[model samples]
Target: MEILDPQNTVLTNAEVYNIVVEKKKAFSSAPKDHRASPALRTVIYETLTYLSGSPAATQTEEQIKSLIRALSPYKFTGAEILQLINLRPKTAVEVQLVIEECEERLTEEQVNEIVEIVKQNFPIQSETKNSLEAAEG
Candidate 1:
């Protein structure tokens, strides 16, 4: 296969979840027996099942954008920022894990602020859990 864009583009769990959900919808709407190959359907089902439990299930595109904007001042790389958005870390330790050279770069207060921002600003929604299962099946 010819290479398309040479640079890698990172996607968050929510983006992946949304894409799979759309594909599943398209597959279900397609004519019978002509459904996405069994293996493909299975993959969609499994992807939905796994992502539904993560923060991605309830996350909106706007929310993700807002989060990226909120954290931009910290000057983390796209990958690092995406990880923070995807993981929704709730503690200083978790923040430390996601960011590189945490001890040297950030003061205790900044770490606390990042933790609080993540914990308070982004809440994991519990409503959509397994909501798509019956439809997919």
Candidate 2:
């Protein structure tokens, strides 16, 4: 994919999940003469579970990519976009905190755009909603 960003980057948790799955497939299909490291495979599986959460049931990698595209105009880096996916920030203040390290400051409108995309793709459960509202209030 021709992402208008630096190399060696991922745009979302789903992309990371995809990488882990591909690695598992590669290790399993390796020639008998070429044994894969069990330790490394274990790490990949752990990371996948950590990054995926339960959102994998609803959001696909392509949907994550579409979210990234929607947010591209805000000029966030791929790493920042991935963080947005993982964090699923629902408010402008929350989104701002997540992207606080960015060199470019986003306007309130830009932040809202990101918040909208995240909410549309990764709807939070009622428990999470209550917690977020309590924290924000």
Candidate 3:
């Protein structure tokens, strides 16, 4: 697993939750025989939770990765790893680079349009905003 910079990423807890939910849906869609194994299901759920930024209870990343690798026996190719890493939050610089790389696949106009839409809708709201405003009064 790649170590992502804590500062550059803009992923909130909600995004992580959504990712976990998507993974759960995928896991559920697998064949019943594969899903029936309690040990396998546990490993799958735990691994997805950990990847989604949940604090690990006991296992280190290596240990969890090992368990998942052993239980699932599905090897991720380099391309797959790269795709997952791309889904992770990135620093401003990294985001720029990614945008550049994907510019051909997506037009500059499209990128700017999407950025504008996000900026319009997702105003930064601090967790303590409500309490702080109330206290000020």
TM-score of each: 0.83, 0.60, 0.27
Candidate 1 displacement at residue 137 in angstroms = 21
Q: Which pairs, if any, clash in model 1?
A: none
When 2 and 3 are scored with TM-score, the better candidate is 2
Best by lDDT: 1
Residues 18-48 of candidate 2: C-alpha lDDT, one tens digit per residue: 6667777887788966756778867977887
C-alpha local distance difference test of each model: 0.81, 0.69, 0.43
Q: Which 10-residue window in model 1 sums to the lowest lDDT?
A: 1-10
Q: Residue 78, candidate 1: how far off, in angstroms?
A: 0.6
lDDT of 1 by residue, 6-37 (tens): 36666788888887888898889989977898
Worst 10 residues of 2 by lDDT: 51-60
lDDT of 3 by residue, 41-136 (tens): 686577666644432222234433443343232243444323323232123333235443544444555545433432333332342344546887
